[model samples]
Target: MQDGTTVRDVMHRAFLGVSESDTLGDAAELMLAEGADCLVVVRGGEPVGCLSPRDALGAILDGADPGETTVDEVMAPPAPTVPADSRIAAAEERLVAEGSSRLVVTRDGEAVGILTERDVLAAGTTHPSAGAEHAVRGSAADVGAAEEAAVDAESADAPTAEATQSICEVCGTLTAELSPSNGQMLCPDCQEV
Candidate 1:
């Protein structure tokens, strides 16, 4: 890889897609079959939204029947995308700005791949500049002190827990607003009616 690598250099090319009309169950099955965490929701060959494992689980938590709920009803709005040739740093910047975990990589306006935070982390592990940039920004001690202060401030004003937090089995989204049913911990959206 070059010193100035682009998103295409590290993006996962085996991206998956699903029809917007498809059911949540269908989307989940597709993810399982493809071994993917998300699927692009398309309508007439154009991307309209993104159906992540979290969305699927959230729907189930909200008590929507997966088989009856359509993908369009639960999918997040179209994911932010970057051109295939965009620098990886640029993609990372976009991700940070949007507070997103991944970005859709496009080529000629067509979805071509996906770049996730994990991918960026892996890339950083092998690139010396990544660590240098962080060092230049702040010393490790400085960061630790800042984190400790933030935690201390938060704890000083912390409120008692009102509900238990749990991870959804189906989609892996952690939620505090949950319901327990039939020994299953579900988010409010996934709880059965």
Candidate 2:
């Protein structure tokens, strides 16, 4: 999902917005009407939190009246922000560190888009830079799998067994975690200029 793919490349440029003071019923209705999986909760025109479908569902199942509950009461805290220029891999790391499934993409501290787990998964399936993605992940098995898939899609020749089983030649930090680069196998860390 990475490999030079910036947050801007995969983030949703258009996201639905909801007011923090709005009734949960109203927010849920808006989500349904817009076919939105999540909504940006706002207060005074500023983003305050994120409202995912799970949040709404939990409130409903808890016997809370959506009409009486406010979005703030059910919404998760504000999502972590990543600059639009940030790498998807870094953003993915932040998502894990924050234990959040979504990230708010911003530029100059102003929200410009949103990135979700779904978007990352979609990119992984369609992105052509699979080898690079796996290299960054530091796993030979992953690199081999991604390479095999790429070769099959393009009908390229199969790589040597060593390519899939070797460690980084430049840095011994990883075992069986090298990717071909300029005819040499190197870990992503070593590939950095």
Candidate 3:
């Protein structure tokens, strides 16, 4: 498929989409349940935008009315998209050029799947890619761990005496920073790997 050079090559076909009318809370719930970084905001079967975890967190920190707010109100519009036949390398370039972490994968102008840095890494491809990328798509051996991590993320906000940190975004190492930014929990060396 086009020499497998674009983002479409490595994207996951099983997409987890959401509606623009859904609430931020619902989106968060879905993300935690699905281990998704972003959800497609579709209206009448047409994609309009995307809801990302960072956006939701920003809204939460701002004290926005998540219950009343719809995904449309917070989603980023005109999402960068690519055909399913594109090369993975091209997709990596697009992500860097756009300064975006998410890309929509379409077939015949309809949403079919989604591509993320994690997805690319999970594919087990040895091809070279962008400077900042991860292979998060896990194998069968990692499914249970992924599910457990999802559950942990879902229940992570609960009150507790101990302050456990978020897993490293790059290495999945559990730490004690609540949320580790820039992969600091693993130290600079591990993050560079």
Candidate 4:
């Protein structure tokens, strides 16, 4: 059942984004001033990561020296992105798989728009599964599949956040709890390189 609606058709044209080198405080300030919850981070003219209010709060709570911290330090990495022409259903699937709330819509590798779960619901896009459709129609599997899907969609629709694994040159760990630097995963000890 193709509705012939592209993500570009439904994406928000005006999105607030940031750069990787920006300070945490700066990113937060921008987000607040712009009335945005998330700030997209870019590098080499490409969508990279996103900084959310949650991320800023976590960094602050962790005693991160705001002046020394950069968006690259806290911005979520491996940002799940979608082509401008992507099908709404495909976008919905990625939103579930990546556990993100927004998706950066790109054209020729350049970000053009953003799609959020709320945006999807507001547009009345059908839920992904039969269970979801039933839930939306108020069927009591009491399962609330649609609600769950909404949650998943909201998170998935967002750009990718930091990954849990990285490649460590020192410990020879191909994928371990590590931080992101310019989209490459580096273990805590190997981050200096």
Best by lDDT: 2
Tell me the TM-score of each prediction against the true structure: 0.61, 0.58, 0.58, 0.63
For 9-87, candidate 2 gives per-residue lDDT tens digits of 9899988888888999999999999888789887754678988787998999999799999998999887888899988
The residue-by-residue lDDT of candidate 4 on 1-193, one tens digit each, is 3478778878898888788988998888888898887788888659888888879988989998778899899887746889989887677667656655678889999888898754554444565432334223323222245545555654565545333322343433323356667666466545755
Ranking by lDDT: 2, 1, 4, 3
Candidate 1 residue pairs that clash: 60-189, 60-190, 61-188, 61-189, 61-190, 61-191, 62-188, 62-189, 62-190, 63-189
* Residue 11, candidate 1: alpha-carbon lDDT: 97
Q: Candidate 1 — which residues are off by over 4 angstroms?
A: 125-193
Off by over 4 Å in 3: 1-9, 121-193
lDDT of each: 0.69, 0.70, 0.63, 0.68
**lDDT: worst 10-residue window of model 1:** 128-137
The candidates, ranked best first by TM-score, are 4, 1, 2, 3
Q: What TM-score does candidate 2 reach? A: 0.58
Model 1 Cα shift for residue 2 (angstroms):
3.4
